[model samples]
Target: MTLLEKLNQDMVQAMKNKDKDTLSVIRMVKASIQNESIKLGKEHLTEDEELTILSRELKQRKESLQEFTSAGREDLSEKVRFEINVLEQYMPEQLSLEELHEIVEQTIQEANATSMKDFGKVMGKVIPLTKGKADGSQVKKIVEQKLK
Candidate 1:
């Protein structure tokens, strides 16, 4: 099934099961997807577009988790962590560090990115290859180290 269809089904299941947290998160995701569709002047989004929205949501939750933890708000941190967990359930399986390294190495060779100046060139090629599978920041760090 499509991502939107799956989200709708899960949303209904959350409501029926009285899972407030899951329901809230799922609703927010739907709203984000709808907003994105409006922004693009389109009636529907592709799975790739949906994954981009999901990734953005996951990034926001991660930032919130860090902020809450640093502020000593354990309760808030816990809630954010739970939301992160829920969001993660819909994300593609993350790439392992080893797998990420291999991809970066291959991209570097393919892009002939031998210096830091070639960072963007390498990233432009790698980002799409690793999208939804690896975090951009992680991939950037790996590329930087390899280039150095």
Candidate 2:
């Protein structure tokens, strides 16, 4: 099933099972996605747009979790973590380290990126290929190391 279809299915299951937390999180996600579409004045988002929205949501939750944890607010941190887990259920499988390494090599070659000065060209190729799969910061670090 597509991500939105799966989200709908899970929403029904949450309601049937009387899972308040699950239901709340799912509703929040649905609302967030709908709001995005409304902001765009569109009937539907393309798959890439949807993935971008989901990734942004997950990143926000992760950052919130970090801030809460650093403040010793375990309760809030756990809640953020729960939301992140729920959002993650719909994301594409993350790229493995080895997979990222291989792609970085290919990107380097394809860009003729001989030094850090050519990092932008390398990243231009890498980002689209690794979109929703690899972490941007991680890719940058590896590419920088390769260039150096």
Candidate 3:
């Protein structure tokens, strides 16, 4: 099913189960998707667009979780962690570390990235290949290690 359809179904299920946390997260994601469509002047978003919105939402929550944890706000951090879990249920299956390493190695080979100077070239190819499936920071770390 499409992401929106899945979201709608889950929203209904959450309501029936009286899952406030899950319901709130789904609503936020739906709003973000709708706002992105409106901003782009499109009636519907492609799968890639939807994934992009989801990724952005996930990134924001993760960043907030980090900030809250560092600031000793355990209560807020726990809530954000819950939100992250809810959001992740909608995301694509994450790439395994070994799989990510393989992709990085292959991309580096293809780009002939001999040193850190070729970082951009390697990343440009790798990001699109792994987008939404792999975390950008992890990809960067892999690419850096491969190049060096």
Reference-based TM-score, model 2:
0.95
1-148 per-residue lDDT for model 2 (tens digits): 6567778999999999999888998888788888999999998888888888888888888889989999999999888888888888888999999999999999899777899899899999999999899778899899888999
Off by over 4 Å in 3: none
- In lDDT terms, which candidate is top? 3
TM of each candidate vs. truth? 0.98, 0.95, 0.98
Worst 10 residues of 2 by lDDT: 1-10
Task: State the weakest 10-residue window (summed lDDT) of model 1.
Answer: 105-114
Could you give candidate 3's per-residue lDDT for residues 1-148 as a string of tens digits? 9999999999999999999989999999999999999999999999999999999999999999999999999999999999999999999999999999999999888887899999999999999999899999999999988888
Candidate 1 regions exceeding 4 Å error are none
lDDT of each model, Cα atoms only?
0.94, 0.88, 0.96
Candidate 3 clash figure, as a count: 0
Runs with alpha carbons beyond 4 Å of true place in candidate 2: none
Per-residue lDDT for 1-148 in model 1, tens only? 8888888999999999999999999999999999999999999999999999999999999999999999999999999999999999999999999999999999899887889999999999999989999989999999999999
TM-score of 3: 0.98
**What's each prediction's clash count?**
0, 0, 0
Q: Is candidate 1 or candidate 2 better by TM-score?
A: 1
Candidate 3 residue pairs in clash (backbone atoms < 3 Å): none
lDDT of 2 at 5: 74
